[model samples]
Target: MTAEFTKRDYSLVGLDSKLAEEKGLANAEWYASEIPRKRMKELIQRRNGPAIRDTAIWFILLIASGTAGYMLWGSWWAILPFMIYGVLYGSASDSRWHECSHRTAFRTKWMNDVVYEIASFMVMRESVPWRWSHTRHHTDTIIVGRDPEIPAPRPPDLLGIAMSLFSLKTGPGEILKVLLHCTGRLTAAEETYIPGEEQHKVYRNARIWVLIHALVIAVAIGSGSILPLMYIGLPSFYGAWEQLLCGLTQHIGLAEDVLDHRLNCRTVYMNPISRFLYWEMNYHVEHHMFPMVPYHNLAKLHEELKHDMPVPYSGFWEVYREIIPALFRQVKDPRYYVKRQLPGSARPAMPGPAAAMMTE
Candidate 1:
C-alpha cells in the first residue's frame, strides 16, 4: 500500500483524489474565519490555553456522580447514571482533549498539554498516541492509509455490525472501536498491527491511560464490589456504542470511494435534539473539512454554507434503525482488508462496507 501514493502515502490505502474538491468547503472557511483574522488558526489553532473552568465543572460533576455511584453501586439500575456520567464527563471533557491535541484547547502550549493530560486522565484516553493518529486523521479524513479513521471495507451484516462496534480501525468506528484499539497497551490483537513512529508519537501515552484505569479498577475492587467495573464500563461502552452508531449513520450509505470527500462523506443538517447529544458530530462532512471549528460553530457554518447533512435515509433515526440489530450479529466476526489500492489510478480503494454493504 505504501508503495504508491508515496509522496503523502495517504492515498495509498483507499482515499480517492476528490476529497479536496467538494463545494461545501466554502462555508468551512467562514467558520474558521469567525475568530476575525488568522485563517490558518482556524484549521490549526495555535492557542493551547487551559479550559480550567470547563474542566473543573466536568471534574466536579464526575466526582459527585461517582460518589452517588459508590452509594448506589448495589442497585441494579443505580449504576446507570454513574456509568453515563463516567463516559460523558470524560467524553464532554474529550472536547477539550481534542481541542488541546489540535493545540487550540488552551491559549498556551503548556496549557494544551495540561488540559490534554487531565482529559486523558479522566477518560483513560492517552494524549501522545491519540495525538499522533489524530493529527494524521485530522489532515486527511478519507485517505485510507493516511486517515486513521477510514477502515478497510467490511461485509455489512450482523457480524459487520459487531466488528464495526468493536473495531478500532478508521472510518465508522472512530469513536468507539478505534478508541479501544488505541487506548490500551499493544495487545496481541494490535501487536502485529501497532503503527510505526510515523503514526505513533514520542510518548506512548498509553501508560497514562492504563494507570488511570488501573487506579479505577483498584479502587472499585477495594470497595469490595466487583460491579463497579460495570458501573464504569457499561456506560462507557454504551456511550461508545451510541457514538459509534452515530458515526456509522453519518456516512455509511453514501457511495464512498477513497480520497473523495464529496462522495464519501456527507454533511448532516442536525436537529436541535441530535446536536445536544453529539454537540454537532452529525454534521460530519463540514466538521471534517474544517475541524478547527468548535461544535458551537458547526451549526453556524451549516447555516451559512447551505450544505445539507445527508443521512442516506431520512435522518439519524433512520440510519440507526437499521444498524443496532446488525451489531448483535457481528461482534465476533471481524472485518479485514482484502485490497486497498487501484493498480494504476491515483485513486485509493476505500475499505468501507464494500462487500457486505453492496449486497446490503
Candidate 2:
C-alpha cells in the first residue's frame, strides 16, 4: 500500500521533466478521434454570438445579484444575494478565464482579451503566468513532470484539496505569487514555461492586481465596513467551491503520462447551470484533444466523437462516485488510477504502466 517506489517529481524543472522528454512524453503527438475534415472545420469555427450572449447574461446576473446583496446588507436576507454574486464572480469567471485564454470564446481577438483579463482578476490567476502555465498543461496533459497544472499529484495532499474547496489554500498562494511578481521576480519553475519576453507582462500584471486590491482595502477602511471586499476581493475565496467541484473531475483519478486524452481526461454530462458556469468544459477529453473547438460547440463535437471514444461519465454524481474512492485509494497506492475502456469502434487506450480497463 505504500507509495515509496511511485513517488514522482512533479516539478516542471526537475529530473522527471528530462525523463519525460527522453521518453517522448513531452509535447508528444497524441491519439485523437477521427472526424471528417468538413465536420472538424465546422467544430473549430468560432463565432462571436454565443460568447457575446453568454457574457451579457453573466454580467446581468452579476449586476443584479451584487445590487441585491449590497441593498440587503446588514440583514440576514443579504446572504442569499451574496451567495449568487459570489458564484458569478468566483465560479463562473474560472471558466470564462479558461475559454478566453484559448481565444475560442469570441471570434474577435480584442473581445477575448478583455474578458480574459477581467476573468483572470476575478479568478485571482495572474493573466500572463497562467496563460503560459495553461499552455504547458495542454501540451503535457497529465504527464507528471511536464504538466504544470496537475491538481492531484499522487499521495495527494488531502488536506490541501479540502482547503482548495473554499480557495483557502490556492487563493493566498496566488496572491503571494502576485506579490512576488510585483517585486520583478519570477520563480525558477515559472521561468521554465513563461518566456523571458513575457516576464515583464507578468510583473506588470502583478502590480496592477496589487494596486486594485489595495484600492479595495482602502475603500473598506474609508467606509469603516467590509462591504467593498464582499463585492470584489473576497468572493474569489468564498465562492470557489463550484470551481473546484467542476475542475476536480477533469483528471483527478485518471491515468497520467498517457498520450491519449481518452485515458486521462473525463467527459461528464452536467446540468444546464453547471454547464453554463463551467462553459462546457465537462467535455474535457474533447477539449484536450481538439482545443480549437469552441465551448458552445462541445456538445456537437462530443456527439460526433462519442462513437470513437471511451464512454463518458453520465453526470457529476457518476464521475465523483468513482473519483472520491479512487483518490482515497491513491493516498496509499499512488500507482492506482481509473483506467478508461474504449468502445469497440475506437482504438485501445494508450500503452502505459497505468493501463487497464475500467468498466461502466
Candidate 3:
C-alpha cells in the first residue's frame, strides 16, 4: 500500500459500486466489458500433463521424506528442516489438486478424477466439499452470501469486538490455525462451508474423506515421537500459511461483496518475482474474470485483456502488499472504500457470457 498506489493501481477492483445504481441486477452485463473469447482460451489449462507431474513429484517427496525422517529421527533438531520441506512440497502441490478438482489436471476426465481424488484425500482437508464449494465460488465470485470464501462479520459481542482489534503474528497465527484444525480440536468447517450444502453429495464425500483422514492420522501417529507431527503437521502448517498469505495478500480490501465482476476479483500482470513464486497467479484479476484460464497463462491473458477489457479497476499486489494489515482487518460490509474512479471501480460490471456449463 505504501507503494503509493496510482490510477492504474486502483484498477485491481474490476467493478465499482456505482454501476449497481446505473443498471439493476438482471441486466448488469451492460455495465462491464466482456473478457474476449480468444483470451479465455489462452488461460485454460492443459492440466493432465501437470497433474501427472504433480503426483510424481509429491510421491517422491513423500518417500524421500520418510527416509530422511528415519535417518534424522534421533536428532530432533535435524527433523525440523525435513518437516519444512515436506510441508512446502505438499503445499505447492495443493494448488495442483485445485487444478485437478476443476478437471483441468489432465486431458482425460477419468484420469483426472482418479488422480485428483488421491491427491485430494492426502492434502485437501475436505476434498469433495471443497470441489463443490469452490466451483460455486468461481461461478459466483464475491456474491456476499453465496461465495464460500466470504469474510464473516466481526462478532458483535464485547469479547469478539475486543479480539477483533488485536493483531497476531501473521505467519505463526496461520500455522497454528492449521495445526489445530488438523488435530480435530477445532472445526474449520465454518471457515469453509456454509448453509446450503447440507443436502449435497459433497457432504457425503466429505464424510468419507474425513474417515480416510482418520486413517492417515493414525498412520502419522504410529510413526511416534512427533515424527508423524513433523511429516504431516509441518507440511499442513506450511501449506496453511501459503494459502492464508495467498488469499489475504490478494483480496484484503477492494470492492464491495457482490459476486458480480465489479467487486468480486481482480488480476495482476507479472514481473519475474511474481511469475516464479506464484506460478502466474499474479494475474489474479484476469483469473477472476476468466476462471477457466489456467494459472500458467494468466499473465499472457492479462496483457491481452488490458486493451479490450473495460475493467472496473486494475490494480496489483492489493492482497500481497498488505498481508499483515489484511490479516487483522475486517474486510466486509462497508464493501469498497474508494477515494477515486479507476478500473473495476469505474462502474459495477454486469455479468459476462455465461461460462461453459460445467458437467461432472
* Candidate whose lDDT is highest: 2
Under the 3 Å rule for N, CA and C atoms, how many clashes does model 2 have?
0
Badly placed stretches (over 4 Å) of model 3 are: 1-47, 76-80, 151-204, 216-224, 259-263, 268-279, 308-320, 323-360
How high is each candidate's TM-score? 0.59, 0.96, 0.62
- The TM-score obtained by model 1 is 0.59
Residue-level lDDT tens digits of model 2 in 1-360 = 332454789999888888788787888878888889999998899999999999999999999999999899999999999999999999999999999999999999999999999999999999999999999999989987899899998888889999998899888889889999999999888989999898999999999999999999999999999999999989998989999999999999888888889989999999999999999999999999999999999999999999878888989889989999999998987778887888898876665432332122
lDDT of each: 0.47, 0.91, 0.47
Ordered from best to worst TM-score, the candidate numbers read: 2, 3, 1
For each candidate, C-alpha RMSD in Å? Answer: 9.8, 2.3, 9.8
Show where candidate 1 strays beyond 4 Å: 1-57, 89-96, 105-111, 121-125, 163-204, 227-235, 258-260, 271-277, 307-314, 321-360
Candidate 3 lDDT over 219-257, as tens digits, reads 776866565655544455444444344433334454433
lDDT of 1: 0.47
Clashes of 3: 37
Tell me the number of clashing residue pairs for each predicted model.
30, 0, 37
- The prediction achieving the highest TM-score against the true structure is 2
Task: Output the worst ten-in-a-row residue range by lDDT, candidate 2.
Answer: 351-360
